[model samples]
Structures are given as structure tokens and as C-alpha cells.
Target: MTSKPPLLASMFAPWPRIPIDTTDGSDFFHLDRVAGSAATGWALGPEGAYEQNLTLAEVVDGAVREALLHLLELGLIDIDSDRLNAAPGLPTHRERAVP
Candidate 1:
């Protein structure tokens, strides 16, 4: 009488498929398909084979963040913390009503 592993635990079990390479020589884990599969629950690989969308979201998110940080390090993008933190004042209607 062995207890079954949790569904989430099983869902995250090691990925069984190997990544295919693109014609341009990039490794194809199909990031776009995988990301979309979070809502669809299925992804099509480069070979047109269906795959279960699992921990790939975390992988894709980390990859995107790494790419953005790399771009920032290269000075290709700017981050204005002050602008991001600045709060917009009250709505025009509220401000007029207050006065």
C-alpha cells in the first residue's frame, strides 16, 4: 500500500524531453509555447510533438530576467527608480471636489 505522490510533486518531476535546436543554431525549449501553455496546459515542441507545461514557466521567467539584466549591464536600457516610485496625485475629479 504505497501512498501516491502529490499531483504538484509529480507535475514538477524532472523534464523527460531533451531540447531541440533551431536551424539558426539556438537551443529550442520553445519558451513562447511553454509560457502560453501555462493557460492552455499543453505546449508544442519544435518537432511538433505535444508536451506538458510544467516548471518551464519558472525557467522562462528566469531566462527573461537574466536577459533583461544583461541588457541593463550593457547600458541598453535605463531604470528610473524615482519615476517608478512616484505616485500619481489624486484624480482630477477628486482634486476639484476637494477645492
Candidate 2:
């Protein structure tokens, strides 16, 4: 048997999901698709349902980081996912593991 190359991993990547989070762990949130429309939204609930809707412009202007964080918190993305472990954001392979 032989190991496959890492570049092949990106060939079947899934589309990114929204990122968001509750400042505290007391809240639970979920994304919901809008019925009868092409748009999607999110909501929070269990005790009470509260939603913070995002505008298209807001999302395009770095607001997506919130959704990314939310997805990370939920373990929706793998620990070694390229988006989370890309270079420049991390130390070089030759660098010491600790400073």
C-alpha cells in the first residue's frame, strides 16, 4: 500500500458554513434555511428563540469570521482542515514548536 498525496484532499472539499457563537456557553444556536426563498438564516433557542440576522453586505465585510468560529466550536470542521491549519497563520515546519 502507498500513501496518497495531500494535494488530493482539496479536490473534494465541502463549501464553508456560517460562523457565529454565543459569548457564553449557555446558549444553543442553529442555522435554518428560509422556506419559499433562496436565502438562509440562523436562530437560537431551547429556553427562548433569538436570532441575529446578517445582511449580505455585512457578511462580505469579514462578518463571516463569526460563522467560521461557530462552526469550529461545533466540530463541524476537522481539526486538521486546511482552513484552520494553513501556513503563515502557523509556524514554519523548521521553526521550534515553542518560542
Candidate 3:
């Protein structure tokens, strides 16, 4: 029998090692795909400490909207149905991209 690929194989592919810098240039963080059988999601944190998977709810939180918008503008994360449905008020990545 043929074996099927892991469910999140595509979603968890190696991401570009880009750091999202804070507006004040105080610190920066990265968004990474955490692919595992037990848990999977976007990991948002600075290097060395406080790395944690972000849930859909957390991503949509008001406190995180600014960062989320920045991420979308940078093309780090693609806008999809799930995200669109989750945060209907947010603009699409294309709409928010910098000229």
C-alpha cells in the first residue's frame, strides 16, 4: 500500500528565517511553523525564550491585531479562508502590502 504524506507537511515546510522587528526597534520576533503530530501552529517569539504556538483566538485578539497586520503586509503568512473567517475585519494581505 502507498503511504500518505503527513497532514501538515506542506504547511510546516521550512520558512524563511526573517525577523519581524518592533516599530521602536526594541526587539524582534519570528513566525515559524511548528509541525508535529501532537501539536501544530504558528510559533511567534523572539529567539532563545518565550516561543509558543499561537492559537487562532490569540491571533485574532485585539492586542495582537497590529502585529498580525504587519505580518500580513510582509507576506510572511498567506491570507486564507480560515484566517479570513476568523478575523473578518482585517484587510487582506494584498490590500495591506506596502507599495
Candidates' TM-scores? 0.32, 0.26, 0.25
Q: Best-fitting candidate, measured by lDDT?
A: 1
lDDT of 3 by residue, 57-77 (tens): 664452245546556666765
Q: How close to the true structure is residue 20 of candidate 3, measured as C-alpha lDDT?
A: 37
> Mind sharing the TM-score for model 1?
0.32
Model 3: which residue pairs collide?
none
Instruction: Point out the higher-scoring one by lDDT: 1 or 3.
Output: 1
Q: Estimate the lDDT of model 3.
A: 0.38
Model 2, global lDDT: 0.36
Candidate 2 lDDT, 1-99, residue by residue in tens: 123223323534433333334233423323311110112232232211133354556433333444455566657543556745542343223323322
Residue pairs that clash (backbone atoms under 3 angstroms), model 2: 18-67, 19-66, 19-67, 19-68, 20-66, 20-67
